[model samples]
Target: MTDVNSRPPSGTSMRPRNGAAKDAAPALQAVAEAERDRLIACAELLFFAYRDFTSDADKVLEQYGFGRAHHRVLHFVNRNPGLRVADLLHILQITKQSLARVLKQLIDEGFITQRSGREDRRQRLLFVTPKGTRLADKLASLQIRRIEHAIHAAGPGADDAAKRFLFAMIAPKDRDRVHALIRLPEALDTTEHLEQPQERT
Candidate 1:
């Protein structure tokens, strides 16, 4: 006699209803975590690399009582003589007030000169003085040495790989503008100087 209320299950499966899905979830989670960790490590390396890369020029800038803003202003003007102030603002993507402060400092210190554009009198054109040129060259040489050393250590094709990586890092919308700027004749011509010492005047 079987008592329904006291009956015991002789054979019953204990597995979860969707055991396969449950197992796959943890595996997918592990892969996602690994990828996140790898990306974070790469980002940290960039931070460290930038710190050391700027360390050399930072010392020289400190001697002149100038900061990174001044260095950037000097570098661009030295590279692109007679650049428009508007164009510079676009390239830097900083507020006009900020640029004005740095520009005034450089101009007052005799490191930079400004003139009216021939075609547009209202347009301010910028250029670096000979003194500024020397400083810019010095800063560039410092960074260039570090870059060349890194490239050598990275082996063949490293330069191209680095350029591609950096280019891809830029925002998609701005990539075309950046590409055009670098492709300018002046910019392209200056590329040769990065590997050679600029003549002292």
Candidate 2:
């Protein structure tokens, strides 16, 4: 006469103290612990990889009395000449105040130059000075050698896999924009054209 769906009375227990549920708890806990260990391993690997990747550049920057921020600003400006301030802010995803501080140092040090935008005089366009270009190239070469060695050690197809992995790490909403920003030939090309002396009037 008892309904199967009825709840147990307030004073009565539905599950035994040593039931199947209690027995499975340890198994679930073990699985969770294993997964956490795997995650920690991956995290540590990424931390070490990034540390080594940037170490060479960090040493170079120190000689100039600059930091990573200066390196990033110089790199982008050198690669994308006439880049707008607004675009740099968007690409770097940093606040105007932070950009201003690093930017002022580069400008005062003769590593960067700003010109009024032809389309909008109110807008400031960024360009790397000759000194900036040399420093940027040197910094880039150091990093490139490290990357080439890593890729070579990883063997064929490793470069493509690494690129895919990095692209996938970008947020879905921002991926398209990132692709557009990074896809430009001007950004990647370092050829005779770039090495040509600027024609000064």
lDDT of each: 0.85, 0.85
TM-score of every prediction relative to native: 0.82, 0.79
Top of the candidates by TM-score: 1
TM-score between model 2 and native: 0.79
Worst 10 residues of 1 by lDDT: 187-196
Per-residue C-alpha lDDT of model 1 across residues 1-201, encoded as one tens digit per residue: 777677457765545559787998999999989998998999999999999999999999999889998998898889889999999998898999999999998999999999998998999999999999999999999999999999999999898778766766666666667777666334233232233334644
Off by over 4 Å in 1: 1-17, 184-201
Which stretches in model 2 have alpha-carbon errors above 4 Å? 1-18, 184-201
**Candidate 2 local lDDT, 1-201, one digit each (tens):** 889899988997876767778889999999989998997998898899989989999999999899988999999999899999999998888999999999999999999999998888999999999999999999999999999999999999897767766665566666667777777234333222223234544
| Each prediction's number of clashing residue pairs | 0, 0
Displacement of the residue 176 alpha carbon in candidate 2, Å: 0.9
Which residue pairs in candidate 1 collide? Answer: none
Candidate RMSDs in Å, in order, are 12.0, 12.3
